[model samples]
Target: MPETSGVPALAVEAPGMEPHPAMKRRAALGLALGALATPALAQAPWPNRPIRLIAPDAPGNGNDITARLLAPQFEAMLGQPMVVDNRPGAGGRIGVEAAWRAAPDGYTFLIGNAGSNGINAAIYKDLPYDLVTGFRPISMLVAGPNVLVVNRSTFPVSDVASLVTMLKARGDGYAYGSGGVGSSAHMSMELFRQRAGFVALHIPYRGTPALAQGLITGDAPVAIVNLVNVMPFIRRGEIAALAVTSLTRWPELPEVPTLDESDYPGFETMAWNGLLAPLGTPEPIVARMHETVQKIATNPMIADRVKLLGGQLVASTPDEFAARIAADVAKWRDVAQRGDIRAE
Candidate 1:
């Protein structure tokens, strides 16, 4: 059998510990009895107990909602109850740390996204876990673009080009809202600001809802928010989407042009969610979980639900997910450095 770092292999006796003649006889009998019991123990299957999935964001947020949507499918496929534990705080650092510290067993997993896994990795200097080494990628579940929306009553700009012209004219006089300092929303807008040669004051809010409220109340006339969270308001005519951050247009907002298509070429940033296990989890368990999740993510029924929630299904392989995470970490690290972004 293969040896894991922390798990000990079954052994009849310790090395260099010889027994006396009488003791040796008893030990032989014990060994024979133990050998008889080993097969049944080894045959026990994985996931005999409930599994825990940690979502490092508040409930109703994209990550949390994704976790809830997939939990039942995972439970049915794995024959174990999958529980979502919400640990929302410190810009997703709290739950990510908790998941990292968990034992390298299949029972515990994390549902993390660009904020927790990508942006935070760039901004947090003394993070407890290494984003690339502390966790094993399971699969990339979904991806959603960010929309640049302005208050219909407050901002006069109509499209990406006009919005850039206005921001350049106004300079730092105009402000924008984001979920937090190091969130994807903040970084996306910062990327835009850097490329467009414009500046806008950043107003940090506690959550996406608060950021949306800031835009609606004209506290911050503009915001780059997740498409899922802001689409409803745009439909209601309370806000107008000027552009999407992805290289291609979002299907939900087909009328809005992409930043790459409008003026800035090759601009593509998105909020994504994926599954990960503590580093050193057994390979067999990881493979099984990945297969199960991929199936669930690709199902037509699940795809329909994801579309309704304004997410595009990715269902990427473990290696693909790992590569994407690395690229995103590097991308955001550069953005944070150039923007001097730090956690509040």
Candidate 2:
């Protein structure tokens, strides 16, 4: 039988065989319906399901806290659940790798920060994903300066100058604690050490809380930690604030001079967290996420909460965030190289 594009050649019917008018009409209607449905299927609305946001740090850490705080607002704006997944390990590389490997269909994103996105990119030579090429910046949620704090009981210094003198006097005999090897805490302290020409052993802990515990218990004499995590202790007089790692003093710790004013001119380092999607995520989705986050950042309640945590709300544009990421990577790359810093 001759073929009729799978219609079976009318079964080799009599030489003049023709499809019945009723059957032809039905076939034409079916074709027309299929054609109409094609565009509808292609244009289905995005985020028809819950979005999985990967926080590349331990629970209660800066990144995880930021993700949890913003998730509700995100869900409200996107009309979908925002599920935060904490996959902490390998100095945040584990979670970041997981996010990078996920499908770029707008359902999976990362709560990237200074540690995972900036310092790690510079120090982790064998990272499974590239910070610049493997992800797209959505928006920067918040930025805060790291505070240089010391154990109130054990640390002899009371200010930046005295701390510098003590560190230089002790050489590598004294040590400082950090959240992790490639963490912002570590890099910030290394930068300060380099500027002050001091040598001190680096003690790496599991997370920010552990680092703070070490300081409180006097196991670690010094540390440069995120302002949010250490602010409460500073207020309680458990940890003494020596200086902030920003060009200018932080509003919350106005009396604590910045490193720039403490002899290290122009010194600055901030710990920031932001949203990022896999590199190939659609631009429309990226734009929508950015705009939604900006709205959340500007909300009175959210803004006030962020301020209480010693952070400044920064709903930066995608381009601006991208540029900041690039600059941070470059700046920390130099610091890491100079300090011979590497993840433990």
Candidate 3:
């Protein structure tokens, strides 16, 4: 009666008709919990979907091969599919630019190599992206010897010395075929000729397939090419592996000596592949991928396949790969300048 206060007090509190104060508090807590859970359910982990690996070449090319080799292992470790996206053109510039432009999300990556990233950096002028700074160096996948090869039945060469002797005698009369003017194949031949003190007329072709055809048909008798490219023909007794350009002998071709051990001591070159991501990828993702690749780099199945296909497994860390890229660029720059090698 003191203050009925126009507010219905006891009459509004019908038994079980209104929620208790404690119950009200509990109800509010439930709403808050649901709001929090919604976000957690909406956002999954970094690799919620298939991760894409862009290979800067055709399906059968080196970068593509490296990507496929990594895919299964990546899937096993990451619990997500790793798909290779082949984007082949413009000496790898097109594919590289694609990777560069991709978002810095952990899902996008590139399968780069000594030629696509290293040699192209040194040779191509005014590139759209910075090769070294624009990418996060992951690790080197595999590296193998670039061998000096000749048509077995057509050329009178068996070893490094014999090839050199033949090259010196033939002089400019000897013609060699390379994929193109500034291709690694062409650079390898130029390096070989300069170091061995000989000259061979260069016959540029559309690509390695054409170059291989030229070698087989005796259109060009000698070529410095990757051992893996001509592996099948070598086994068929059509092409002979004279000397490898790596510092050490390739395991599959153990009988063949390295250029560093032959008369061209200190001579070394290799076809290398590595993984890279767009700059600004999270550190945790980078570390995770590096650790996974390191663990599986020595997988027997991958090792056996690489060996049989003529490759060497190189599981180098990010720092090592970065240093190698820098050094490789410098080496190729010197080679290009000395040999007048430039991309048209």
Best candidate, lDDT? 1
Candidate 3 C-alpha lDDT tens digits along 204-306: 9888889999989888889988877888887787878888898887777788888888888889888888989999998889998999888887698888888
Against the unseen true structure, what C-alpha lDDT does each candidate score?
A: 0.88, 0.87, 0.84
Where does candidate 1 clash, by residue pair?
A: none
Candidate 2 residue pairs in clash (backbone atoms < 3 Å): none
Runs off by more than 4 Å, candidate 1: 1-39
lDDT of candidate 2 over 1-344, digit per residue (tens): 45455332222246777878876776777677767877999778988999999998778778888888889999999999999999988888899999999999999999999988988888888987778767899889989999999997777677788877777777456889997788888899888888888888999987788898899999987999999988988999988998898888788888989888888898889989989999899999998898898789779998888899999888999989999899999999999999887765
| lDDT score, candidate 1 | 0.88
Question: What range of 10 consecutive residues in model 1 has the weakest lDDT sum?
Answer: 3-12
Q: Where's the lowest-lDDT run of ten residues in candidate 2?
A: 4-13
Model 1 sits at a Cα RMSD from the real structure of 6.4
Please give the RMSD to the true structure for each candidate, in Å. 6.4, 3.8, 7.2
Name every residue pair that clashes in candidate 3: none
